[model samples]
Target: MNENRHSVIVIVIIIVGVILLSKLFMIQVVDDSFLRRAERNAVQRIIDYPYRGLISDRNSELLVYNNPVFDLMVIPQEFSIKDTAKFCDIFQIEKQKLIERYTAAKKYSWVKPSPLIKQISTTDFAKIQDYLIDYPGLFVMTRSVRAYPDSIAASALGYIAEIIPRQMERDSLHYYNQGDYIGHSGLESYYEKILRGKKGAKYKMVNVRGVDKGSFKNGTLDTASVAGLNLQSTIDMQLQQYGEKLMKGKRGSVVAIEPKTGEILSIISAPVYDPNLLAGAAYSKNYNILLSDTTKPLFIRPIQAKYPPGSIFKVVQSLIGLQWGTLTPNTTYACNKALVACHNHPSPVNLFGAIRNSCNPYYYQAFRQMINQEISSNTYTDTQIGLDKWHEAVEKFGLGHELGVDLPYENSGSVPSSSLYDRIYGKGRWKYSTIYSLSIGQGEMEVTPLQMANLAAIFANKGYYYTPHLIKAINGDPGKIPEEYTTKHDVGVAAHHFDMVQNAMAEALYGTAMRAIIKDITIAGKTGTAQNPHGEDHSVFIAFAPKEDPKIAIAVYVENAGWGGRAAASTASLMIEKYLRGHIERPALEEYVLVGDFGD
Candidate 1:
């Protein structure tokens, strides 16, 4: 019995030895992962960051470029310094801040590298390089920060910021790191994927002192990073600069488009700061100030702020009426102030005369004809049917919906439909009399400055418009644009109906908008004074130059600037003269706009 038990024990020992030997062979010879893990102390992986794309205007003038910056990285396991005070002094960082950063880094990863300090300028980095040797785990990584040369178009150019924890987790491809920068707004955010190039990797050998010896395998395993593709924007920098200049000290926005191609030549939001303020190391400090300011300089008013279209919308009313066969060019209505108040003008005028004089009663009576078409025996049902039809026609003009501009977060301004009225006033309860405020572009009707600019382009084309976009090309190739920008949208209005309206707008300059007339340029335009219950009226103007074959279409909205004939019209005229003539011949008009002094 004793001999048999000893034999069983011997067999069990032999089986266990065989299993251990097989496992050792599998780990040592079959897989190199364990060996690679062992080499982590001596080897370091480095990220090769690609240069961000450049941005230039239609004139080939540089708008945005990059400047080299440095980030200080730390591996928590190897991070140890005998003199913490001296390190803080070199970096100008507080002792408590340093401790917090180090603790955060340690929590992130003991083995992996994390950012200790970010966006140190080249000059600042140079001052502290010699002292870096005293810290074992700390290393320098080179990257670039955005630089705006001309310092114009702050709202359009946008800004970039570091990737946050949530953003890193959402990175499906695992591209961004903790300290990496990404575009935050405007064109930057809209074209982020196209503007951010692919990243590469480098493996290097490091001594115990953290000194770089050489490439890990003579760069055989290293990959090359590709620079991002450059963007050729549609903006004319000179025109954009001039527009911003004219908007100085004013609270509003300006948008200009090429009537033929739908390319945006200039887009300006006033109360703009130097774009450079948001770049480099000063981003957080300056951003907080801009955010807290009561004036709200950060607001991108062109696509975001919605307001009543006011008298400028009368042009659309006439077109819709003409298309639906509710009114005609020869339709006449008396300038009866009882329907709505109007300035002194000829009474009982035709369409052309009414448009030139901006006769409010004519539009009121014309709108009545449209909404009270006698489609149903019940007055309420007939009003509903007529309003639904009108709403459908208005939607074709790109009102009440996003125009799909190549920018992030564009607001879809409201256009009241029959259903919206139903929600407010209950079904079958409201009619033309309750909603007549829409006739003169008031009440629930709203539009963005960008949409208004597009309206001007539609009128310039006589019945159609292309989608407005800022990007003209990618990597110098204009043919790579999206199909949407190239598509022509017809407003469903007959082309002939525009002739009378165009003729009237040209004559309008000689009447209410006389200040908008430019020398040698026959401009077709309409002025608007949008009423504000909380403050003064907003000045608004829309125009296209050389009424015969329009080249540029524009919209200007100045808040609390009184009559459109003053601030808005004058500014639009100066912009037209500058863009068309290449110089401003009327310095007196330019000075008047700059002064911005309209008596209360």
Candidate 2:
């Protein structure tokens, strides 16, 4: 009986041992998900850096490039504030500020790495890295900071800034994390897709102390980033500089274009800031300064500002009158210093003479006739038909609508229709007399300097113009434009009308713009002194030189400057002389223009 009892007890002890072993196996190996989770919590993830692309001008001049900057990254889950004082000293930040930044970063994300300090110089980064061993959660990361070589085209080139909250929701695949740079305005903003190259990623292994161990899995899934395509603009650097010099201390804008191709040669808006002002670490403060300036130096006036076209608009009126057959090359009206008396000329003055004199009465009669003429026998009544035809002609010329230039935030100046008149003062009740100022390019007719320049181009091309464009080509391909831009648009005016108007414009240089005439250039131009109720008249001029094979067409405006011939006309002349002859022939006129001042 004792032997049987001993055998049974031995078997019972063996069974108990087998049950405990099975439980140990299940906890340690069979269900290992919890163990794996614990291991992942210990290891941190570090980002692999990518270099930003370079931005170059059409001439291959480096407008914007990148410099190596360091960001102090922190993983909140792994973050431990063991050496707070030493960390603050290394980063040259206050302990309180560091704590605040750390707290904010934790609120944003715990797994994702956040920047505690950004835009640190390479030297400072090296110094920090040397002492990184003293801190538990801190790590140094290399990033690209924007650098500008030539700071001339600040508003045109624009600046890159951290992506805002609004942009984050717009596109998440672009993977724009917090503090990522994005184009803010100008060409940079317009071509953001092409300028901002594709992003890349690489998984990195890091230790519990946030020190990078190696590439995760040997970087088998790493992607190499592509650099952005370069851009070549039609802007002439020399001409741009010259135009800016002329506009310095002035509030107006100047736009010059190649008449044949509609390529923008120069676009200058005064009160420009240095591009470097928005670069590096001082951007926020400088941006605030620019925003607070009353002059609005950041404003691009060439396309954004709308001013009365003044006499420059007379060219369009003359063309329309000729096309309607109501005005002839020999048509004439006298400038009698009074509206009624000026309507009747002592003797008939030819159309050329009328334009040369800028005869307001002649245009007044012609404008009235245009409104009274019929488009067809049955289409509409005389006034309605004439107004409809006039609207079509104006629209064909790209007036009363956006010119569709590549620039952002362009203003489409007001071009009042008959319906607009009806809304203002009951249709058919308001006579042409009420809107007579439109004939002189005043009243509700407003246009930007860019539009004025484009009008000059159309006239230069004899009623056909290429769409004005700033970018000539990208990567050696002609820039894409609309079909209407590429197609020829006839103004429905006879070809002879251009000749007659051209002659009158030539004579204008001898009349009001006499001082603007070059010895052998044979230029054609018109001058305008727009009425300004708040201050002195705003001087304006539009012209194209060497009339036969026109090279340059220009439009200039001088705010509060008396007489279009004195300030605006002279400026256009000097610009033409400089562009065509490469030097000013008239030293006296150059000195006069360079020294003459306009009261504010």
> How does candidate 1 fare on TM-score?
0.95
Hey, what RMSD does candidate 2 come out at? Answer: 5.2
Off by over 4 Å in 2: 1-59, 77-99, 121-136, 172-175, 207-211, 340-348, 374-384, 479-490, 583-600
- Candidate 1 on 467-532: residue-level lDDT in tens? 999999999999998889999999999999999999999999899877788877999999998888
lDDT of 1 at 383: 90
Candidates' C-alpha lDDT: 0.90, 0.75
Summarize candidate 2's per-residue lDDT along 1-600 as a digit string, tens digits: 999999999999999989999988887989897876865654444444454545554455666677888888887877786677866776799888888899999998776678898878887777767777766666777777677765666666677888899888887575677678888877777777766776666666666654567876687757766666566666666666666677677777788888887777777776777887877667889999999998888888888888888777878988988887777776666554566323333344566767877777777777877786644454224555567667778777778778877678888887777787778887666656777778778888888888888888878878877777666555555544335435555656667679878877888887788878898898888988877877888888989988999999998887788788888888888888888887768888777766757431
Highest lDDT model number: 1
lDDT of 2 at 46: 45
State each candidate's clash count.
0, 3
TM-score, cand. 2: 0.85
lDDT of 1 at 333: 90
- For each candidate, give its TM-score against the true structure: 0.95, 0.85
